[model samples]
Target: MSTAAPLPAHRLFSPARVGAIARNTLTELTRQKVFYLLLLFGLLLIGSSVLLVRFSFQDQFQMLKDISLGAMSIFGSLLAILATAAMLPRDIEERTLYTILAKPVPRVEYVLGKFLGIAGMLACALFLMGLLFLLILFVRERGVEAEMAASLSGDAAALAAQIETLRAQVFHPNLLAAGLTIFAKTCVLAALTLFVSTFATSQIFTVFIVTTAYFIGHFQATAREYWQAMGGAAWSKAFAGFVAILFPDLQIFNLVDEIAVGVAVPLALLGKTLVLGGFYVLIYLLAAQLVFAQKEL
Candidate 1:
């Protein structure tokens, strides 16, 4: 029998090779109807913010902010989990992974490709919802400002001038903080889903595990405290410590309330949290690569 040709190791890990995988995964994701369904649901939730604003008699701006921020978080989290889980299993079930693996592409490149593709979709969802949020906030703020101006007893001209000034102050950096915080929070959640997708064998299991992890990751500190209160119980403490190391500290990225209340924490603190999130993403992706490498097609 003729000798099989040795695969070119350098070409297998090249950036171009990885990018092609990412592109293919992205195309596959876009073609799936589940993505469009979620997008429609997300848009519907975002559109409902106008109705939410109408119900708030006191500080309608706060109401709008709450709904908009919440919609982004919920939809983004779902999209991240859904996309990451489905992509891997779809390839495997179709027997397409075998063909791809037979090429010069490494399994690690495949994982990274899937991760980045899902991430790109999440980023798009965030941007779309983020724009919707800004528009709703703008419209609500304008309506409130106009009402206040019309209620003014003095000249209309002076009232209009005052309203313009108020609008400027309303959309200032402090007010914009909520939007920024929500985006950061989405990144953390998306990274988490990506990490979990690496090990999960089935799409349903991946979604379930990632969703549970998302909820518990934020409360791990509370678990630690509970363990401490148990009087140094070995099993409890061990479980808490295991959780602490396994999950990313999600509370660091949760600044929605602080932003809503206009509290100014140091920007440096946010920067540090973002850096930690990045570290988690890298570590989890690396772990996923290691796992995927050993997994048989």
Candidate 2:
């Protein structure tokens, strides 16, 4: 009896397979109760910022952007960690991982597919939150303009100039850059969590480890600066350097404060931050694949 011809090598690494996996993952994630709860909380927090009436218009606008951006960052990070930390362990627990791996799907493709799904979810969440934020800002801007126009009715030229200034402040182009950077930061966290989950025994352990890494990442730059400035022993400096390499410099993605206070984020700086985030994602995904390939299903 003649056996059927074996499939070509290129078919083993097909994008179609990866895309299918990604769509499946995304559907699974969206069905979770935690996803809806977190998204609702984030939207509420952003909307509540508009109720602060004690501050002047300028201060209110600043606070509005600050609070909204901060909420987006926090919620996005939490979602990334929680969602990704559970994926691998959950799949393995349900024996779904075994079935997937039994196919010709490569380990690398599986990892890439999972991360892409999480990334897509994050993008959608950010878009919704950003839309609400922009809406609130627009409403507030119109209200302030009307109030000022009524008070300065005698001076038509001055009213037009003031309205123009308010529009400029409310609609700065850098705000978009700030939103993009926040998304990038969340993607990095998702990738890191995926790497940790590859070897983690349980979902709780993965969450704990990734949460610690998140805190450490925020303080990484500070620790590196202090160690280098103190002129420590070789081992001390070497240890600091090791940490610097292992944990991402999350501060580099912190443009919320600057953007909050109306400081313009340069296009070049935004590009650099995005590039750094992409680098971390690539490195962690590669590392996860290496570990996952040898893992016993």
Candidate 3:
């Protein structure tokens, strides 16, 4: 009996394989004690913001939101960088990468799997932090309501109006949007770190390069504007353009300040920021695949 022909190379791509790799990556990352420690520290930092009750109610809420969101963003970014920067190198050092690639898995799928794992972990961490933030806001609002009621006991009408206003401010829907923006920013950072890790000689080198890129990305917009408005030389302008294309303009993802200050984030603006973040993620993942495909085992 004649055997059937093997499938084509393009048909070899399998979501099941990608999913398996992603699950394994996620398990490995979750088992690291450093991740738990970092997460606990972040939660404690957020909870500590409740101590800023000396300010007026509005100011107190503002500070609370500001501090909580800032903690999330900073911690989330650090986790993204640390988790992604170490993944590839650790796998290689342990020979897991060789065994995995020795299978039928394509390099592209492998890269995508690794990124998905990181993204999943980030999503879980953000969700936990966000839930705590919302809970804190709810509790603080209740405490403030009690204070307002006690102080304005003689004026029930004014008390109701003030409580309603406080409720609106404390639980603004924009908070959800802000949380999403922070998550998107972290995802971009994770993808960028992964891209750097592909060719980096070691985890330290990958982390260093990604950290530099993070700073450059945050300042790239301002630097570009300064260069263009200064009417600099051709080379300066060329350098600015090159930097702009090379690093993502991370400022666009900074809706935390606006949300903290109670500036309404339009749905359109949130959509644009998320899309831009996703674009950067896709670009970096593609670059990583290209570089990784040529990398020898």
Candidate 4:
């Protein structure tokens, strides 16, 4: 029997090779079945919206917006961190890393492909979850209009304006923007987690550190201000500056919270967030490649 010819040695870094690794990585993550959490959240969303109706209708809708968007942010971050953090160590434990690296693949391609796969999976999860959120919010919007529209007894013009406000608030473009922001944040977390996994001996260690970093990122601005306030000594100031430069400024992405409440974000700011995230992803992947390449398999 004849065997197929091998790919040219120089093409090892090509997209085709990189994409193959990514495809396998995606399949591996999918088999882990963590994505079932998305369905569970969808059910929670419906139940929560229904229960929220017994409380203030106006407040309930806003709460719905918060819960839905916030859930996506929380879930996406957890998936990105846990999934990417575990991947490298697990591959090593299973001896799969040696098998892949023993082939024609470059270390950079392997690192980059793994990140792409994790990111693609994150994007898919966010999009599906976001769509489900929009559907639930639409249903809540219609129910609110049906029950509250007539009950909104006021000056005719004022009542009409209030109704329009509710409608506009529920179906705003801000929801999609919030979804995109969550996905971008997930990419950043995945890259950072992958970088940590390169040297981490255990998955628990990687997860704990990444989770802590994520929490700190939320208050990066406040921490910076406080550090500046503590300018009594040069050593203290230098230490604070070093930390600030090392960790990402994650507070900047918290605009999703405001956007969920119907506050509009400028397109320029959103574009900047995506670009910043892209840079982090690029830098982390390169660093991961460098570290993993030198690691004893």
Q: TM-score for candidate 4, please give it.
A: 0.90
Residues 1-297 of candidate 2 have per-residue lDDT tens digits of 999998667676889998989998888888875467445755565556547777899888888888888888988899999999999988998888889988988988899999999998999888878887888888888999999989999999999999999999889988999899999999999999999999998899999999999989999888888988999899999998898887888888888889977898888888988999999999999999999999988
TM-score of each: 0.83, 0.92, 0.91, 0.90
Work out how many backbone clashes candidate 3 has: 0
RMSD of 4: 3.0
lDDT of candidate 1 over 1-297, digit per residue (tens) = 899999655664677867788788777777775456456645665567546655653456666666666666677767776777777787878988888889767788877777777667666667667666677667767777777766885788878787777666446565445555555566566556656666776778888988788888779878788778877768878888899988766777777766655577677876776677677778778777777778766
Candidates by lDDT, descending order: 2, 3, 4, 1
Q: Which runs in model 1 stand beyond 4 Å of their true positions?
A: 1-12, 33-58, 156-165, 174-195, 229-232
Error of 1 at 160 (Å): 5.0
- Candidate 2 TM-score, C-alpha based: 0.92
lDDT of 4 by residue, 1-297 (tens): 999998655864689878988998999999998799898879889889878877887788889889988889889998999999889988998899889989878888889889989988998888889889888888877877776657766567877787798887668877777887888888999999999999888899999999988987777678778878876578877776777788887777767779977888789988998888899888888888889889888
| Error of model 3, residue 70, in angstroms | 1.3
Q: Taking the tens digit of each residue's C-alpha lDDT, what string does model 3 give over 64-93?
A: 888888888988999899999999988999
Clashes of 1: 0
Candidate 4 achieves a global lDDT of: 0.85
User: For candidate 2, which ten residues in a row score worst on lDDT?
Assistant: 41-50
lDDT of 2: 0.88
Model 4 ranges off by over 4 Å: 1-9, 148-164
CA lDDT of 153 in candidate 2? 100
